[model samples]
Target: MTHFGSNTLHVSLVALPDAVISTLAGILDVMNGAALMGLGDAKAQPPFQIDIVGERAGPLPLASGVPIEVQKSIDDIESTDIVIVPSVLLASGGWQKGRYPRLVAWLQRMHARGAMLCSACSGVFLLAETGIFDGKDATVHFGYADAFTTLYPSVTVHPERVLVISGLREELVCSGASTTWHDMVLYLTARHAGATTAQAVARMFALQWHQDGLAPYIVFEGKSDHGDGEVLSAQQWLAQHFSVAKPVEEMIKRSKLAERTFKRRFTAATGIAPLEYTQRLRIEDAKRRLERTDASIDEISWRVGYEDPAFFRRLFKRTTGMAPGAYRKRFCIPEFARS
Candidate 1:
């Protein structure tokens, strides 16, 4: 809203007690570097103005227990071109509702005033609190997708995406996982500064975009915290014998509940259907085997219960975003095999 030049965007990083300092530092380095490169003069004033904005001005300690001096408070910043909420160390209890009322209000005001707002990983949780992401597509760490979905059901979560750009005018930007902060900053640099400046900064930082997405990194662990003893027992049994033929049907029999009841309870407890649960267990087994063994994809597929190697390959690619051979090549440990 207060833009001065094509390359000049006022960038503000929100500082919170539980914020990840490394993410903040990475964005600062990339943005500053891009600004310097765009100006083409080390001595000239950088085109971009970057600041650490906190709830209250002064020193704020991050989750790392290190203090960072904030240059401006949320109250002091009336308008800014861009606001970045860095990733935070989200506790198991999750983002407490109404805990950051002032910050949330300020974020809404900024969005309403035409300032672009961005978040990385769990920072999306904070940004969501502002209601700016309602009915919009966003992304966060895959591990936290369920929690985020539960907390903000209105915001569709694409856990597998490395980045999601949404909202009216696409002013709201989100990046998945903690490290994708690099992608978000680079995107901002390319948009406000120039693609050339962004490329130079990326080269300097050795930053790479995670094009493979979070699927390859997600480990399928069955959710068992629900208070259903039958579902828990079924999950445990499936874990040991997922490759068995008609495993979901066998699990239903073992659960001792009616077919519909068992299916309902399993889906409720695991957040997936019985058949999907079995597939995940089998895929997890295949992943481990691929990581530690030199077995052919056909053999591994058969070992994991799928008789049709072609079907297994397709499923593997669908669930993991990588073919079996690609997964093996990426994850296999040559040192372990040698040992």
Candidate 2:
């Protein structure tokens, strides 16, 4: 392990051709800002020394077609305190396995040397390629959850978390979604520097940390690619009629499968039982109504198929971790009634 001087820490931002340019630049800017803030203090020098390192030194074009000048190549760096892999624009065929063997090998070496690895969004794909995240929990962009799970089945994917720290030593840090670079940088700043410095940087950037998990923004679209014809038809029917009370019997009859068979197949395909699926669908609709309409919680709950207002409130809180009124208050349009 490379021992860092008491006053300074080295950081490497891995520059990839397919990386999102804004994320890379934004991380660098925030780190520099933190460093500057620390430097202003008489007793403390800046803790971070950041470098933009690429697979090969020189200019590397981002997915946006903008070229970022890299200060050093990965081969030139023998050791660093931290390594940050920025998100990449997924290609048409998806993240190609073994596409950057050299970079993967370098990352492996760095981790083996005890440097912490942090990834943002799809950058988790690269870290997964190193097998470092295998058997560990990690998060990535919600859009890529299915693909990431399909690719790395061993790693537990938390699609709803904005950030996750895994590994026995907690050396692997991951941030979900593309814009979560703000959250990741702030977290790193707080971990390495201090809360005061992190808060100052947050104030400077006007960046608010999203403490709520990503669940509120996620729409529970039923997965239908399970290749079960009867299940697919039932799913389609349920999607159209989730607001209907007592959908299980109707779904089973429409599927033409016996009750046991229908329930089993639906659970296997969707990872949730039929009634639970309907509840999720109804709650999803209720969330939409809460956000876009001035409707009261009881009215919205009944409209979404709940007959018991108290039951609906509990279910809403259980599913979303917030009361129905709180959800509306946070998400409802300002022009709509604020009740």
Candidate 3:
């Protein structure tokens, strides 16, 4: 949390196999750009010294198969003010145990030396494996939430959050999704360079803060791979008839099990209760309508099975972190925004 006064901040971005190429390049550019701002001369010493560090000191291929020359190796960097882990390409089976033991050990050592650790998107998988995030609140791209939770049950995963800060000194920072690196960079700038410089960088890069979190972008496809045939049938039925009156009751009846058994199985398979699943279905439908049409909130709510628009508004906001009108304003077509 030290500001850039006279000492130049050393920021290191970890370059590992499957690390995002653009993210490494982007962070290097932004941090260096922030350092050079208001220096009055091109040759002035920048406030930040940015380096791309890898396991080895050489060209490394990223997830996109593009090669970036590493400026330093992890062995060369004894310590740094900040260490950023960019999103990696998660395999179909998700984070593998002991796949990157060297990198995990390096992260643990750096954090022990008081280097702030930050990650974006699936990069949190690496940090979680470092064991620093065990008892802290963290977040990742919503699509990876279930897998991340399953892998690290000790960590508190807030899938709806856009940014999460936890650690003894609030140095363990994480951002949701890939593009959210913009938010993370700006936050880091503010933390180390002050708000004025952070704003300058924002204006320079046209970076906007994502204050509304990740709920609006989350597609609620309930867990359908849990292998409960009866629950799967009920899920399919509800998908087509989620807007029906008393849909949960109808689903329970169609499930052929006793109501208690049906509810238990549904929750077991989907990780959500039947009523909550129904609500998610309705909210997702309402979100689609809000984005694609100029329909009034009341009309959309009624179409999505809510009898009262007021109640629907509350539910929509609760589920997505934005009011229906606000969601529409943020995501609707350009013409709709202008109108």
Candidate 4:
């Protein structure tokens, strides 16, 4: 394993064929900036020695079809303080095991030798493939929660959390969603270098840390592909009639199954109960209206089938972790506001 001095941290970034180029570049730029900023202080040495390593040493094509020249192969690196795997473009089958056997082995070796493993968005799948995240809480893009859990039943998947620190020693860290490298890098910088240096780097890049996790942006569409024909029919009906008040009884009737069986099948297929599914649909609609319209919150609430405005407000906050007004202020279009 490579050894680090107290003054400098070595970071190895894994570049996969379908990796997001911007996230890779942004991480490098931020680490380089942190190193340079630390150099500005006479008392402190540079903070990071960053390298872009891949499974093979060559020009790798990114998701955007741009080619990035990797500095070295994963086999070339003996050890690093950290390994960052940026988001990958998931295949239709999702993350299949043994896809990158050598790379997975290298990651396992690095972690066994005490490297901190970090991933953003779908890159978490790569880490999960190494079996490092089993029996630990990890976060991924909210949209992938069901797929991820279904794939790795042992790992505790927290789709709504912005970041999660796993491992008994907290060596594995994960960030949620695309573009969450902003938080991952900042948090890493703070942990390895210092919070002060992290702040400077954040200011230098005009980066805004998402303190609210992934709840605010989640669009809660239920998963409907689980092959339960009766449950699928219920899902279809709910999609067309989600705005109706207390649609569960009708949903059960439509499914043509006993109440207990319908509830079980629905939750098994969708990973959520019927009532929560309806609430998610309503909240999703309310979020869109908040972003696109100037209607009062009460108006939007009633339009989405909430009879009691106060109850709607509470449910909105419970679902989204943001007040309706705050959500609008953050996401509202100026043209819509004016109109």
Candidate 5:
């Protein structure tokens, strides 16, 4: 395991210089806090180092009427393990040529040398502007997806998911909205700091340990302003436990409905059977584990509670139109190799 100082995953924040938004800074605050807490709790320093770097080393204004001084410049970003570009105003208008001149040059220098490029929220817009996210699997905040899609049609944008870590191409990742940033930091922490260290950090902050590939949006905990009591209860349970579907018998017990009546009621309530609903939940869970964990097909099958890998394979392949292995190749953000 590495400490923050030891791992030091330098993050370069590309501020739009007068972009008037501190979204990036805010994200940095949270990430740095998480890192410090994550690493400090493990009784170790995280192997990661985060730097809010940009075109220059100076004060940058935010939409909140505040300015944060930039401590690192483009030249200072050399050989960084991770370069993050936060959301800034497009008015800078430097990335139109996929070459914001200085930004482009910096990105080229680091990218060519195999550094990871990370984009947060609207920051993804700037990354796309660099032509680096092109043909890559990425994501933007839900609000900005439409504009991003309209602007960069060549890049494959995943709308349903909150964050995307592209197929193991030199550590490129694009994520925005929901708790995606939290997941990203945890991932980086685990990678640099190790799972044991990461767990220690999580325990320190009382943060729940997360499995990569589960989108933050799927955990909508607060009650919606609409829906009946039974509906809301079911929906809440579904949201919380969709990854590990409750047994139908358990659900029936909880609902206190007879089998025949429960079937009719559940179907009428959500237009889906209890069993079917649970199946969908398991499928989604299996799909997530498939994409994130380095575990083999059998390992993943078991992780999702499938006793028979063959049946899991059939169900997965049938639903996704590709074998589990092939699906991993097709949809996995960080493509695996036999190291």
Candidate 6:
């Protein structure tokens, strides 16, 4: 339990000249929803509010052609309850020109004054650039692990994770990718809004998968009988090429079993039928791309070998409880929004 008497949580988004504001804005929307509902606490005061800050104050464009207006500045850094930096990718590949040096200095200044700062995805670069996380446990996008490790050898990097929460003395650093941005902010939401309100927000957003206790990835531990070398080989091979166009009858022959026996054994071995397992693989594959790339729904459907966009949408919705667009929005904000 935390003391909330006269205490406020201030969220500051570290903005660059070309940063995607909506990407961060969407997260604040989720946080706002939680806060407005009495912020999950009868004793706690209403949330202080979220403000976007950078060198200047005005509208900022997203890659999606959407220009989001800003209402604050890095000068607001000193009074922030908790500051957040969105993962800002840079062309220079380091925190110099094309980066916010003044904001970097501000982070260092605020940390020294005991203010908490958090980062999302590439935003870790901003904090790392300040050298505040040296010798501390921090995380960034998995794809940038090499560059991050090489660039900041003084820090302990947590790769292979979408989110990382670091609490050190007076500072708490929370960060991850956009998908994980939901998780980090929601965790804060739960603290301010209470568990019930946080759950409500998660349900409304169709983000049950972002639950605090859930693992980022599922690990299959099939029974030994199912993993009987040959069966596992068959499963892996089937995963490699079990397309919708691939005939199940041909695969039955390949498995050396009658169709009925094949179905039963497949279910027995994997807790799902062979065809069902193929769908799982395809869905997982689709999900990964949805998280990593900025492809349109129709394009993603084709890439995953689905011929009908409508059917693809249905399957994706059935599995994820959200549409492809929302899924992508949850991970990487689209290019048009980056404008």
C-alpha lDDT of all candidate models, in order: 0.86, 0.87, 0.86, 0.86, 0.64, 0.67
lDDT of 4 by residue, 196-266 (tens): 77788888889989887788988776777789888888888888898886799999877678999999988
Estimate the TM-score of every prediction: 0.88, 0.92, 0.92, 0.89, 0.54, 0.57
- RMSD of each predicted structure: 3.6, 3.6, 2.9, 3.7, 14.2, 12.0
RMSD of 6: 12.0
Ranking by TM-score: 2, 3, 4, 1, 6, 5
- Candidate 5 shows a clash count of 15
lDDT of 1 by residue, 1-339 (tens): 112243457889999988999988777777787544453454444557899998999999998998989999999999998999999988778767788889999999988898998998889999999887889999999888988999999999998898999977989999998798888887877776567666777887789877788898889888888988889988888888888999988988887789999898889888899988888889999999999888899999999999999999999999999998989888887775666
**Cα error, candidate 4, residue 318 (Å):** 0.5
For candidate 4, give the lDDT of residue 69: 91
User: What is the alpha-carbon RMSD of candidate 1 to the true structure?
Assistant: 3.6
Candidate 3: segments with Cα more than 4 A from true spot: 1-4, 37-45, 336-339
Any runs in candidate 2 off by more than 4 Å, and if so which? 1-6, 37-43, 333-339
In the range 1-339, model 5's lDDT, one tens digit per residue, is 334444456666667653435456555664566455544546654465677777778886654557877788888655877877765554433224343578877787888887888876667766676677777888766655556788889888874455678745647776666446555656666766566655665565455533333332332123344454665576667655644544666666667768788677667776667666665567677667767777898887776667789998988765545578876765677534525
Winning model by lDDT: 2
Q: Write the per-residue lDDT of candidate 6 for residues 79-108, one digit (tens) a residue.
A: 666778776655554544325678878887
TM-score of 1: 0.88
Model 2 lDDT at residue 60 = 87
For residue 76, give model 2's deviation from the true position in Å: 0.9
